[model samples]
Target: MRLNIKITFFFLFITKVCLAQDWMQTPIPGIGNIEFPSDPEIFDQNGVLIYKLENDDAFYLVSIAQTDPSYNAEIEANLEEYYEGQLEGVEEASGGTVTFKQDIGIDGVSAIDARISGVANPELPSLLFKRFVYVNSFNVSAEFRPKKTDELEFTALKDQFFNSLQLDVSALGSSIVVDEVNGEKDAFKKGYEIGYVIGRIAFWVFLVIIAILVFYFIIRLLRPKKKKEPKATASKPVTKQKIECTNCGKSNSTEAKYCSQCGYTLPRD
Candidate 1:
């Protein structure tokens, strides 16, 4: 009977895995959208919205909260401290201990990534991977809890679910807006305008400098090099001219008045 039960459970597990192959994108009201490997069971616990998906191997969950405006200032003041409190809350609720925690960010918003282990019950999932994102007055949390940490499918699903989240920035309103006016400006507004103009001027100046440098280098490289001229060689030393003697057809030096062999008269140069 035990062996038969094991076989049935194995088949059920495989069936669940196969069914989860088709993922779906789900949007939470007032928060953001994320992908789930299968249709999630959504619940509202108090003011928090929870989206949950479970299989025989693991449990996936995402929770979102639009926090009170009063707490926004405190959260903004010390985000790390707020996250530490959140980590402690998770540990207390799950009866687990955080094995590792890392500071992370999503879309310029501060966040925390953490792993929890040592749950109270061994039958329950003892390993958990979690991420908490704080944006404006919103808090988003995602978690993946699996029976075994080494499972490749669980790891892949965790990564996919975490990466698929996209926050709806439009839902979060801006705190400040400045408009153009011709009237007298307040000190803060005047300073802001001056700084803006200076920043633009600096940016254009930097670009112009870079362009000039590039142009200079291009001209220098393209210019032709001057060709070297060959040096003039020294002229050969002049040799004394020889005169032919008419008497005996003997050669005589230009300086000689007469030929030595025939005593013939020679013309002077």
Candidate 2:
């Protein structure tokens, strides 16, 4: 009886291990494979590829779409704006308020991670965790909506779903490049491109002008000032020397003819 019990326990343990490692790999062309906890329903809607999986506790979704060729540079330059738009769209669709948001990167690719709470639903109020990744010309999204936010299993599943996404860098190297000359160009789009370029150039020129003005003012402030010199004054005139009269023994001017007190004539030199 004891031997039979030991064998049954061993078999059960082996089965549990196999089930734990039963993640399914779903391949996405031009991107990479994502490991789903179970087989997900895949479909295409309006040129966007979508994969969905649902269980009693939570729902999982993955979406992939190719971006318009003309807006590649704009999206790359303004990644934050693109992310904000995506978050806003999610909020509007689910009627949820974004509770947490973070900027992240996967395999050197920029991404945004956000959480939404207070989603309005008649059946159950749901919590959503979403990740938006930009891979070259493709926009990849992964989402998890759990029925119960406080459950440990749901949290672990959320982490597993997000982490299982693998991007193949080798496939991304041969990216699709659209030749604009061969395609029809809209006049409005062309004008917008020209205006955007002009705006960028004008912005840089303004910044350079501001920098030069600031440097000039700083130089003026730090430079030493020159000192002023004192003015010259006029000199006083010298007085003539006086002479002594011999007879009166009195002093008189050098040009005097005689002494005034004695009435004697002055001797000529």
Best by lDDT: 2
True-vs-predicted CA distance for residue 79, candidate 2, Å: 0.9
Q: Rate the local accuracy (lDDT) of all candidates.
A: 0.73, 0.76
lDDT of 2 by residue, 73-186 (tens): 889899999999999999999899999999988887889899998888756447889999986778999999886657687878888888888888678633432222112123
* Residue 94 lDDT in candidate 2: 87
TM-score per candidate: 0.54, 0.57
Which lDDT tens digits does candidate 1 get at residues 18-123? 4454566666545556887666776667766678898765788998777787888889789999999999999998899999999977766778889888777666
State the lDDT at 212 in candidate 2: 69
Model 1 ranges with Cα > 4 A deviation: 1-21, 148-151, 173-269
Clash pairs of candidate 1? none
Best by TM-score: 2
